[model samples]
Target: MSISGLNTLKKGQHYTAKELDSFISTTDAVLLSNNENQLFTDPEREYKVTHELDGFFEHSEEDAEKHFREKKAYVVEKA
Candidate 1:
């Protein structure tokens, strides 16, 4: 989510945590996301990288992709 994108969530409708999470699933950035449980980020793509693979750490985009191809790590991004 972008700075202004946060407003999309706050524009007049009060949302519950579960309802907000549904909205957060479609957002484009992490920091502006409504999901507080999302604390991990890939250093390479910043907002585009939502979750880290279990038991895996990434320091670079290339490394992340490599692991992804090998099914060692996976990421979550909205379509």
Candidate 2:
């Protein structure tokens, strides 16, 4: 029930709304499991924006149809 890995859910954890809000807003974007093992990063450190994309494609059927109707091309450059 965790969204963006900030424990933004309290389905059974009994977390207060304010507590969840604080964690979601202030805590770093990192994953923490029940085993207390930190994955993908050091919990105390901030991560850098390693990459970015200019645009993305419409994945939904309706959205893709609309995109094609509008004559928008979903282009992907070859690496």
Compute the lDDT for candidate 2.
0.32
Number of backbone collisions per candidate: 1, 0
Per-model TM-score versus the true fold: 0.26, 0.23
**Scored by CA lDDT, what does every candidate get?**
0.35, 0.32
Off by over 4 Å in 2: 1-44, 63-79
lDDT of 1 by residue, 33-63 (tens): 3333453332222223344333343256645
Could you give candidate 2's per-residue lDDT for residues 1-79 as a string of tens digits? 2334552232223332333334547543322233233322333332222222333334566545533122211111111
Residue 41 local lDDT, model 1: 36
Q: Candidate 1 clashing pairs?
A: 1-29
Give the lDDT of residue 29 in candidate 1. Answer: 25
lDDT of 1: 0.35
Q: Which stretches of candidate 1 lie over 4 Å from their true place?
A: 1-7, 11-13, 31-79
